[model samples]
Target chain A: MFFIGWLVIIKNQKGKSWIKLVESKEIIEIFFHGRGGQTAITASQLLAEMAYEKGFIDTIAIPIIGAERRGAPIMAFTKISEKKQIRTYDSVKEPDYMIIFDTSLLDIPRIKDTIKEGVIIIANSPIPIDTTDFPDNVKIYIVDATGICIKREFMHSSGPILNIPMLGAFGKVTGYYDLEIMEKVLKKEFGEKKVEKNMIVATDAYESVKEV
Target chain B: MSKARKDFTQEQETKIIKGNVSAAYAAKSARVQVIGAYPITPQTTVVEKLSEFVDSGSMPGTQYIKVESEHSAMASMVGASMTGTRTFTATSGQGLFYMNEMLHWATGTRLPIVTAIASRGPAPPWNIWADFTDVISQRDTGWMCSFCATHQEIYDEILMSYKVCEDYEILLPKFVAYGGFILSHTSKPVIIEDQEAVDNYLPPLPDEKGWPHIFMDPERPMMFGNLIMPSGFYSEFRLKIHDAHMKAKEKIKNAAKEFEKSFGRNYGNGLTQQYKMNDAEVGMLIYGDLALQMEEAVDLVREEGYKVGMVKLRYFRPFPVEDIINIAKSVKVLGVMDRATAFGSPTGGPVSSEVKTAIEGVEKTAKILPMIGGLGGREVTLEQQTEQLKILIKMNETGDAPGDLFHGTLWHGKLEVE
Candidate 1:
């Protein structure tokens, strides 16, 4: 069973490592902008909740905008720290990292506000973007995640399943949580074989960032 | 290279593909009992795939419904979803527009159904491609819209969407878009996760007993869509959908999170998708295929030393009014791009329509220009987009409106009336 394997991974890896951290570097806020069915808010909550179970302290996931009607832009956020209390229930103001489920959103306003200094930006676009004009402090990472995902044939119709690889890279770079922790959760959630594929993408993203 | 590695397990490879087709397979795999379909380009492939599944017996215990029109398709799903059966439906372009009336009924009654929509431009000569105007045009309809940027997102979203829509807190219906050409014609390897993985990701519906909890009791019988007097009619009707909509926001979020915990993939929450705008001075707002082009266009401008960004309106219905206002507040100028035109208006574009409304409440003056492009599947070029960006940036610096209806294609050289 996928769930059983996941539990084993979680138990064997850290037993209960993610128990809310007392305090960490800073709060990592990531904003997902996609339609109702796209799993915008769910992505944050699932990552946060599962991490919470592992013992990560002050981890929170919440959606900041819109009614959950289909075809609307749903915004969900995740915050992790070692601190005991995360006072704010509000949405992310200056996200340390931002993921663009739709590259087209690069044209929309305010998506820019989510990014802060040294933010890692991932987008699902077909072509590579020239981020030369980006602020000196900001590091832009643009991937044809959709194009690459399609090429890999790992994508399904409803939406991009690329988030796994995206998350894989996110976990590797940020150390927000252990990649093994994610691997364990994924195995528990997705099963062993699926978890293996996700790990590959995650590792690929992790390696790709170093070249940049 | 120090740590030992496991042999990689590759994702499944498939033949030709489209986002709608992926969505269809998801619904079929989810064991949807009834699929109500109305033919429309882009969206047509989803129903076609489902029919194939039903014909091939790949999906057991499923009824493939071929409805007369989009309206009937929605009407059918509304009835089917209300009757405690997992239901599915799809439409696009004018087909979705035609289904407008039924959409209201589905959400008003709090039906937890799922529909796949292809965002295509509206009619005149009748061309088939993708555009967000069709979906964005219906921003007030009350359904939760999920825009799929890639086929994988489309697949995961379809399953997750069902879970979210069915939440008792969010009894409203959901609309999932495959983003026309970007996803519809695109083919790639899709990791067909074990059926059990999907099962674990999405739990059984809460109303397992049967059907949604509607006020339908044939014994004593209650009125459904009967005439309402001016006394308390609007308020009663308004509050019901309003309560459902608000509850749906939280419900959908929780359900999405649950799906994420079960599945390794997750979609974040928001009324819209935000791209690189943290340090941007000007923002471009768009949807569907056009948004894809604009995304590239912004990068081109960034190369030219302009701080440009974008937001794709994924959730069209229950328009993210406050979110838009907040987005608008951060920027000096905003370029609202609409593939469909609403004639005789100040901006003459669907995107400009609501954006103008949202900007009105803000303090700073946002130079809002409504530019209509890519009508009837007309190819919008990068150069034209670059020109629009130049104008938008200028407007951002100096609040002046340069009245231009269509920026690219044949409209560029044509003289405009003062």
Candidate 2:
């Protein structure tokens, strides 16, 4: 009887997997806390562009946050899916992901306003995220992209443009996209040599990330 | 209707293209689908001309969105570009400063939208003069930044920026145009490439196919950016964006090259342009409209017994750190001039800061000096520059550097106190 029940469970799992391949679609709202020059908006654009190219027509909206200079913290949003038109212009009321470009922003009070239950937070720093005020359901991920860039011989040690590797890790966790599509999107978005190096970095990041 | 015959056989050819206006015309000619902007000096003509075209039905299926502010202008284009439309906007000086918040957003989203800027001096009493500070300040915004020196180049590069930006190899949008006071006021002839020619140059717009399509799904809904435990998430994505821009630099260069090869005219910046620099011991580094003055000064200095060169910085946003370092290695004394000042600092200009950063470890006898000149439209004469160069060359020889503040309008006379 136990064997028979086990076989039934396996059959159900297979059916669900097949159904997910055909019927699954989503509208995810991501909130990013970054300053001017950071890749908060570009992150969403890459996702939207890739989704659009893959026949998943999505819409993205980023509210103008502040008239601040470089290194000043700002906020932006994105929405993606494969359904009807997305017309709502509201800021992400409850973001599913809260990505902070600068970990130094933790020193600023009320930086946690973007956090919510089940919200995943990603930061571009070597230090672990300071989530003392965050909810128990909130998860945090941190990597020092500035360090990665320097190691890879990119530009001024100035920290910006870390979305490529983070997206790779994000894709691996969610299983939302295959590496092939992401690489293609990166190539289309960035170009060849960069795409090649970044793809290696991204794939390595994906491999390095430990699923929580 | 009967028309009286007039002398229609006059072969006429003279279409003035102001830098900003030319950029707008180029964008329109490139079949931009949406124009989002707010009026600002120097850059106001860009949208005004675009409005005229849309109003006159010269361009169809193009939405001319008038926003309340520069911030909204950028935000609107961010939305419009997501819809797979070619989007553009323009601003100048404080307007670009105001849109600073959205600049990163536009680039972060990797939207290949193009923007024309009429660079002007920034705030504190609000002066409208051509300066690189506004554009130089946002060099970290992740946009493919390029400057146009002439009105014709503005038209060509505006189109070129879009072409390079929208290339599948380079998805980030770009900022291109000269200063308003210089290029906007100075009218010159520009070759308006036929629409057919432009269409042939740029790739067809993004289409729905095997590429990821954007849509709203309700039933099988999933989250876009959901909470993921950092078993490692943050560092990875940031690298992706950085990688894209670094990769895009070469792609942009290649696209510009290809555009030149196709059109038989290369208005795009060939990496960094060096004028009479190969044999020069002293060089002046300048950007935007001020570079023209530097070039003229170099010419005048060359006539004398001075081996002087001028480096015109076109792509300022990427900072071009490596290239600047390489150039700094050769020149004995590098005099960096900017029309903008960073209050209370050794390096009063952004260009100086980049040069200093790039040459941190260079083992050379080169001396770099940053000078703030021509702010608020104060004249920067060749004589004044020559005098400055004499001092810089002497400083390089004797190792006796001048004080941080070289020249400025004195608000106070020599105080009559002991």
Identify the leading candidate in terms of DockQ: 1
Off by over 4 Å in 2: A1-212, B1-14, B210-232, B266-269, B343-346, B395-399, B402-418
**What local lDDT does model 2 show for residue B273?**
72
Consecutive 10-residue window with the lowest summed lDDT within model 2 chain B = B1-10
Top candidate (lDDT): 2
Please report, as a residue range, the 10-residue window in candidate 1 chain B with the lowest summed lDDT.
Answer: B1-10
> Cα deviation of B126 in candidate 2 (Å)?
2.0
The CAPRI category of model 2 is incorrect
**Tens digits of lDDT, candidate 2, B1-418:** 0011121111222243446667877877677888996998767878999998889777766789989999999988887876667888988888888888888877666678788888777777676766667776777787778887666667777777777777665578788857655566444345677665676786557553311332113443433334657776656655766777777668667867887886677633455678888998887777666665566556645655678887877776556676688678878888877666665554666667667887888787367776666665554544455455555666667776664344421111122346
Q: List DockQ, one per candidate, in order.
A: 0.02, 0.01
Docking level for model 1 = incorrect
TM-score (chain B) of candidate 2: 0.85
Q: After superposition, how far is residue B400 of candidate 2 from its true place, in Å?
A: 4.0
